[model samples]
Target: MKIAVFTWNLQVYNHKKAVLSKHVVEHIMRALFGHAATGMPFIGTLLEIKAPRRKDTRPYSEESIEKIVKALQDEFQSHEFKIIPRIKAIDCGGLPNTREWILVIYSGFSDVSIESLGFRKKIAHLIKAENLKAILKAGQRTYRPRQTYHTHGLADIMPNKNHFEKMDTFRIDLKKDPMKTAKEASRQSKLLHQGDAFDEDGDLPLLKQFRGETTGIYTSDGSDYSLNIEAIKKRGTKIANQDENWYRDGCLIKAKAVDSKGEYRISVVSIHLPGPNHTARDGNILNTFKVVGFRSNPDILIGDLNTHTEVIRELYRDLSTELSTGTTLKFNSAIDFGKTKYDRAILRTTSIWKHHSIAITAAEEISSRPGKIQPIRYERVSDHGMLTVVLHDGGS
Candidate 1:
């Protein structure tokens, strides 16, 4: 059996007026699965999909997972498809908008089960736990008390009442008081553990809670656990100043497929990592593997990694999976930036699949004028090209 898995950053969030038109949705559906003339089953890992809100009306209404699925169903005319929409509410630098999502759309598979492992959330929890532990440890440290004048005799010895006022103005340092500091740290850690540290109104909202449309084991609760003060400041600074969100996450899909020889189980992961910060991206990749567990590797891992550094490359290499080559990004005339590949798919050599081939779409152009080829105006679809990895079962 040969399965086609594709990863694309749909860029719906970047759309003009942040609206994805019906025609654009249909174009995406056709461009991705329509070209599979070989009748091979397809699994599409689409990223940066903007979820529709009730406040959005008219032209903005069609930009949703439901609309995308409807377009796919209309294009394929088959009822054998399943969609796993992992809606993640992003914190856009304390901004009101939190609408981006990731989607895993599959077709022509009967025994397929997709799930959100919550590995990323678990990683956040672990990091928070460690941070709180450190704070608690710091709070337990003994500190020498600063010398202070006895207030009873200080006023009599003072040159004027102004000196007394100045002495009274000195604030008591929390570090000098271990008991108070410990109690405060304990209270904050408890609030964090109980998910009460965050302001109720400021919490990121999850779409699954209201829509009830997601079909997976895990629907994100939109709880952020990266509570380290410095980490929060770094992320906040980048989000506010650089206009980029550093929150990253992914999901797992398990399916059983049959070939000429026998049936085999396949594991696929759809991932999206932080884009602007390389350090965060690297840590995210490392924690992603930890979330996935180091014991077993997924058969296929696909998504936008924003891979521009060798650290990311080496991390994937250490995982025994090689990222598919070729430029996956399209030229941006708005930014005057040339093409570069950041989106990719990894097919594990240790997996059941024996052979593989990759194809990149939505990044090239055909000439309307005779013999006058031109670059694709990819802004119609996305900033990143669609990457499809075809894995063979090595059976005749």
Candidate 2:
């Protein structure tokens, strides 16, 4: 089984706001959560102190908090899910005299390959409830407590919190900082390029001319699962899979690879659409899937598509009617403490669904906010967990 983990928006800061350091902290937290099956490691975190120290910003009344905790415990016990570790934090965001907390409850299959992992569905449903309750209660606080979860940002929960209040929005000086500007510009430029390439003359390069001294391009390309962006660009005329006008969170990454049936393909698009932007993004997804080249031949379209709505069924129906083949992206990161809904990762082919084993696997949300009153030592991470799946070689 093949799996991929996706995390977004990991912002770590210090009390002075000037001491913002997210790189080391983010990596540490990811390493901890990424390798949790081994053992609980004391992840290192920098401590900050101030004239006014971190205070408990939990908004829930004691009575209400107990009720919520009881509810979560009752649901967890009733569902038979094993309890994972939960961490709380006192101060985050580098805000002086401010207190915050984030609690992450990790649980997953001891062995990922077991078919019984589907039972995690029950746990996912319960965990989401717990998260939702926390979101609601935290929203009621005097100050909107920062979230340490994957997707449940203060914007997602409160929706009305001042966006300026987000501490990570510091205007990074790019002009005076030539290295930073060059790096970001180069990164964006690479992302704008839409093919694969190799350093040597063999394969293809995604971005043609901007090849030398570009450091992060390789990492970015590999992150999108491209072997060599330069190599793919050399293979064929890189064409936009869909309209250039439509700008969504995902991109159109295409390559030519042999199909399962042994036919060389013209174009393959790897997309990563945001989970929340369904209506417009779904239309783009359907349109791209229905394009002429993708419809007729051996091409693979795969990525994190945040759409798991009726739109998916509609796409299935349309593809079925056209005699084309497609499957909804499968991977569930839903835990019991929050709303449990699986984001999608779809792979489409000319063949029907029955011919292949498309296993959509669920992983636990590794990013979380420490609970209020607990000292925050780790980084503030994204709330959405990762979803990885494998399409076996023989599956149609």
Best by TM-score: 1
Best by lDDT: 1
Error of 2 at 147 (Å): 44
Q: On residues 1-396, what C-alpha lDDT tens digit does candidate 1 reach at each position?
A: 877777777665443313333433344455545643445666676677664544433245344445655554454453222222222222111122433556566665557666564545545543433333343332221111111211112112213344223222211323376445434433333212122212234332211122222110111111111223344343442211111122345667777766567777778777666563653433644455444632247776777656554323222322213434433443443212234456656656667765466666653332222223653233444566667677777663
lDDT of 2 at 188: 36
lDDT for residue 2 in candidate 1, whole number 0-100: 77
Q: How does each model score on lDDT?
A: 0.45, 0.27
lDDT of 2 by residue, 256-368 (tens): 22333553222222333323444343343444433421432322333333444422322332121221122221233233223323233334444232122222222233443
Q: Name the regions of candidate 2 deviating beyond 4 angstroms.
A: 1-246, 252-268, 274-298, 308-342, 349-381
Runs of candidate 1 exceeding 4 Å displacement: 13-36, 52-64, 78-99, 126-188, 191-248, 278-285, 293-296, 310-340, 363-378
Global lDDT of model 2: 0.27
